[model samples]
Target: MRLRLRQFRLRTGPHEHRVVQPGQPLRHTSLRAPEPIGTLLGDHDGLNRLAGLFSFAAYSRHTIVHVPLRDSVPPDEGVGELVDLVLAHHTLGLRPSRWPALRRNLVGGTPLTVRTDEARTDRDSTSWRERHERTDGRGDLRHATHARTFFLFGNRDVFASAAMSLALAAGWGPRQKGVVKGHSAFMTALPTLVQPPGGGHPLELLVCFKPYPPYAHFRRPGRRGERRSAPS
Candidate 1:
């Protein structure tokens, strides 16, 4: 069966930016500032609704690692604590140890760190792109050819247009397989066009619907619960 690979980017904020190459420096920074806490929470709620739709699908085994490319300042609780914050608030399911060496390598290094929450704020966007390329070559990321891989970026266009080009130019397509998923105000903002490497399959956009706040009104209360009197 032909695999239905999908790709896109996650837009954290108007100013949030990303680099596709993994080891290069971020050439530009997002003009938008970090999203407000309320907005983030709302987005998470939407994601949860979407997740419910795929609960029954037979998804392949996959691991999610949080790369601290940006927001590297160690919170009062440190990187591990920050990872937990992402989990509890966003339900992203990222583990703390997935990128254990992120702190020391955020700067002066390849710009890619598997560390927890070390603030990577200092480095510009190009760094993450360069680091992603390096990791794709030397790390478990190489498994993409055999297993489906997805690189979720802050902006799909930026990474796809920039990073994919670099990978192709460097002769890395045969080894890397999978797609990019872009996150925007809504998933619909992602582009419909995609030119796969070396005449590969075209990129596809997958839409997952998120439940809106009004859904709560449609839900019925449990039988065991005592009902309160309706207001006149």
Candidate 2:
């Protein structure tokens, strides 16, 4: 599918999240894993704005993106182009895996519900330590919101996660928002390290979309394209 790319500025709130820069390696927070790089894109009253929420939730001044409606295209071709877009923009260090499952989800119309708030709740639970050690050990967990659940990517699966998020934003079907306090695999894996040309936001890219429900929250606000601060 053909896509239109646009550039915009976005700012982060006060949180200790990493930002992507040009010619730098993808750095981890410690020996464990890297913090998720949050990105948001949508349109408001005929004006499209791509903003960053950082670690928490804030919109100030930096750089982000907004993918306007994508051209109608077949699923396989669309996925291929998006994968190329992501890889062309950043070096993800992808492994040899064919990403069969990721392609399946995109082509077969699998429903994905990301509970972005689950990590926090899991951290505060009394049995947190036991659960962390027993499971992925990263405090990132996924459970079915209903019966029609599918696989969720974590454990440094940045390439697949990034592709999935881009596909969802660009018209991949059956995307919905749920709550999970745990860390976000997709957000953490988002490609946000490159510096835009001509001196602008630290990281910026052009994406394409078809008005999916996942980003509907950004379409209308108290004011059009108003600057919003990160949440405390």
Candidate 3:
């Protein structure tokens, strides 16, 4: 079935001044500075609208005009650029725990709708509502404005690893890239992407952890998500 839809991609990078890797696992530093520092990676305009993307089938359902990624994650076919952004963010040091939100923030019973009120919904959050308002909350984010919207079609782990595997396949890694391993656990735990629980299909990845603080360089990827480059 052919469906007319707008594609919106949510790809952003660490700011030039920020260090991409965390030297140590964040100690819940303070609500003001959350561990993964989601916002530190900077904002993308299409964030809100991504929640509304739909599959071709949804186009037939009148009540819903757009399909959401979590509903049915897309196959990682031609999403290399988006995947590279994921790898780079990890390479630069965003933690695995925080990566999911890079695409979706359904965590903590967060409401699906934006909080129209100006006040922060939760003091401890740089939430969807908060970010929407901070960035002027335009609900009309669409493909006309951004092209990378296609990446939002899956939950973080599967989507990220599918992309990461491509990097692994290309021989890009901490060892060859010479970049510090940001999702250190990814290197060891997932050492290589493999067929998941269902097996016999495209491989999936395991969860990655953040490095502990105090910053000791890992001798290799196996040490732990225990040491990394922290933002300066």
Candidate 4:
């Protein structure tokens, strides 16, 4: 199941040049440049193939695979093919005996498929206007339904909470080792990797958010006024 996957370190922005020359004056600015967040290891060729299979604009970058993190309303035609590709090349951290059930659930809309196309509807229609006019606690109907899916090793909620705690640590640098909390389940339906792909480091935490922007920052609102919390 182990494979040679490309490892990419996720950073918030472009690398800053700190070296100053002899005659150059020290330029000071309030703008904080991007910093490395974590590492992501994935199959380069497989990711390209997966992107080609989908009709939507899909690409892989530092922290995210630019594809829909969930299945769409009408269902994407390439979901089966994408799942097959993933199962063939990557390990879902499931045991040999659990493949059947896991495979079944995955194909049955398990939130793992990388579907990206948004549900199509008449943009200028009356129903669309009515639907968007309503508001939820976070925002109006225009607001996207935001949720997080945590990939954990043992007890789901416990590890999820632990992962969130670590993510909230703004001071965690690239060299800092992250911890995966909770006792091992031995073998279960949950996906838990002992080591991440290329780095072979202990897989501590991975959080997937549906309908996220291509970039890492989440402080700003969407074009349509949808608000998402900024990562600390």
Candidate 5:
């Protein structure tokens, strides 16, 4: 099989999330996750904007990817060149294991639906999660929404996550989570097995992400005015 590369861009900084610069996370009461403090992507126009960039949904419909889901690619090569560049040089302290991932079909951005009898017990519940899982629990709790999700990730983790997201997008389908949110540049790529014009099967690469001012800093609500971002 032969493989080619295609590219796309997902401008994520426009959404509520930003990169975690090298400093204390200026914790926000209204932010998504509370940890080293990561922001979560939510059901907003931002997600829709990001989703509009990819046509994996359309591409898959038009063409056939040569690689079989069972024949998983290696972590080093699974997501392809651009992500490999990210993991290899951009990501600090991360190893190949950090990039382990699976692929799925590219579905809608978020707010995907799932069915259940009762409700969602997960930290956060969303129709998308259920759809990704593609199942509803047999119990009473069903059709839960608003599951806590990582809409954006801390800078430390974003690089690694982006690779995983791409791998995931190729398989189960593309969704909002398939992006690595960053301050200056949000990164995402699509890994697909595509049909070349010659009629043989090959792998293809698609890349994209939101663009933002590199290191736009915001003041903490309180304290000595800690910052989630540092000037680049």
Candidate 6:
């Protein structure tokens, strides 16, 4: 099995849990387990994203056993120790083993229901009521909406194969979004795969870098020695 590790900053909403609201935009940072098992099957990136999003920081730090399944058992379960290490480093007070619930819910065959609410006040449930009363029913009323439901797969290969199959069955068009960025190793391997004797798969990877906006402007010289407007 081959492994791929990655990191990303995910943008989320203010009401979203699992994020620390420090007077800034909500973002999630994570370190995923190596995807050796996922690489063979093909949906490495998809699977990694799924795990990163659902795998809460608290539980994974404790219960995740990194040893190969074939290895002999250690005298003492090290999950608790691993959890402690994570807490000490990140200062996030979360139990490491609590993640099995999330994993089970995702991997289980049954359909799962995810709930979200716009106005939730745990400390004072009447906060919303008071606000609504003060505004005389003209205040912004937010309702809980059901977002997309993701059918969980055990590994990356299955996810990729399913996606490719779906894309082939459903004709590609404007609604379909292509890959934006890929790891350097994956980018290098792509050229060889696209060489002669290989059919070019109807797929594309669009790499978009953030554009730097002009902070200041200056009058510079042109090639013809004329004054030109430039950004500094």
Query: Where's the lowest-lDDT run of ten residues in candidate 1?
Result: 139-148
On residues 1-232, what C-alpha lDDT tens digit does candidate 6 reach at each position? 1222222122224321132111111111111111110111112232222222222221222222111111112112111111101111122232334323322332212222222121221212233334544654332211111111111211222222222322222222211232112111121100011112345442221111111122122122122654534635
TM-score of each: 0.20, 0.21, 0.18, 0.20, 0.19, 0.15
Per-residue lDDT of model 4, residues 54-96, tens digit only = 2121111111112222232221111111111111111113233
- In TM-score terms, candidate 6 sits at 0.15
Residue 18's lDDT within candidate 3 is 16
Q: Candidate 1 at residue 40, lDDT?
A: 15
lDDT tens digits, residues 23-134, model 5? 1111211112222222212121222212221111211222211111122221121121111111112212222232222112221222222121112212112332334334
The whole-model lDDT of each prediction reads 0.23, 0.24, 0.24, 0.22, 0.23, 0.21
Residue lDDT tens for model 1, 1-232: 1112121122333522121122321111111111111011112222222222111011211212222223322212111112111101012332234323322232332232332111222121244445545654221111111011122323222223222222222232111222111112222212222233586554433222222223232222243564534424
Estimate, for each residue in 83-103, the C-alpha lDDT of model 3 and write its tens digit. Answer: 211222112333434444443
- The C-alpha RMSD of each candidate to the native structure, in angstroms, is 20.5, 19.6, 19.6, 22.3, 20.2, 24.0
* TM-score, cand. 1: 0.20
Off by over 4 Å in 2: 1-41, 44-93, 96-106, 109-112, 118-203, 206-232
**Candidate 3 residue spans exceeding 4 A from truth:** 1-172, 180-216, 221-232
- Rate residue 88 of model 6 by lDDT: 10
- What C-alpha lDDT does candidate 1 achieve relative to the native structure? 0.23
Put down candidate 2 lDDT per residue, 40-123, tens digits, no spaces.
222221111111112111111121111112221222212112111112112222222422332232322222222123233223
Per-candidate count of clashing residue pairs (backbone under 3 Å): 40, 17, 20, 2, 43, 6
Better of 2 and 3 by TM-score: 2
